[model samples]
Target: MSRRPDPTRRSEQSRQAIVSAAVDLCVEIGYAATTIEAIAARAGVGKQTIYRWWPSKAAVLLEHMTRVRETQIGFPDTGDLRVDLLAQTSAVQGLFASDTGAVWRGLLIAALSDDVAADGVRTLLQAAVVEAKGRLATAQKTGELRADVDLDMVVEIIYGPLYHAWLLTGRPLPEAYMEEVLSSVFDGLRP
Candidate 1:
């Protein structure tokens, strides 16, 4: 006889489905046009099921973005600061070029007026920055970076342009652009 599926496991599967549906709908239809009823129908669950776990449609979108960013964003150490930064910046470029990028932009738009969405974006981005800062601190300790360099400022110098390009300038973040950004930042960061 086949073993019965665990209720907790089933519940988790349903939760993942809902989050996935929310992200897709948010990207395909834009966040404002998406609704709890539509999310339920897309996820093959009832509207009450979504309400049981999340307070609102925005909450579901926030949770979905949290899951995506946690798994996809990271700063890796490759011994050389330039190499490490290149890899990190390249990953950022790739993320902004993917469908998730559209969802992220949608979240940013939602954040302009919604406190919950704004808080969620702020918290999620802060976590990513914290991880990158740790890598910068390690480089400083190793003498790879200037001892007096401000980690927060360095991070902003590196990532601030990427966000600006994505949101304000609408310029392409290609490999050549990543190289130039890292080069300019490293020129001052070198000990």
Candidate 2:
């Protein structure tokens, strides 16, 4: 007799298949066109299987992005605030220049219309903000930034314009612009 397949392994396979299908469909059809039905058909899974594992297509696509792309930002601690900000912005610039950025653009567009998708996007961004906040606090402690500097405001000041360009203007986040951003933001924060 053939050995029984492990239920856990089977479940994981199904989960991955669903995620992969969701991403592929989103990429091929655009986020607005990709549906749970299409993802199920593409993944060779039943509708219930996807509904059981994810609340919505947005949720699945959110997981897909997290698993399929390296969206995590590692804030460098070069001791110089300008250096660290440049590295962080450079990484953001590189991400926006890649295929993953196309997916992100789709996701953001979907989020604008879908509240569930908006929440998912907010959650992902909030997690990154939490991580970046720690680094900013460290910089403040080290006297690189003024003790009175508001870390939250500092983060927004540093990254908000890049996101604005990414989301609205559809412009590239170039190194020169990143340097200009840092120079402007840091000018106010000097200890």
- TM-score: which candidate is best? 1
Tens digit of per-residue lDDT, candidate 1, span 43-78: 999999999999877788888778777787778898
Each candidate: what lDDT? Answer: 0.87, 0.82
TM-score of each: 0.90, 0.86
Task: List all candidate RMSDs to the true structure.
Answer: 1.9, 2.3
| Candidate 2 per-residue lDDT over residues 1-191, each given as its tens digit | 89998999999999999988987877778777888899999999999999998899888888866754344457788787789888887787777766666667777888888887899888878877887888888888998888998888988998888888887897665668888888777878889
Clashing pairs in 2: none
lDDT of 2: 0.82
- Candidate with maximal lDDT: 1
Summing lDDT over every window of 10 consecutive residues in candidate 1, give the lowest-scoring window.
Answer: 170-179
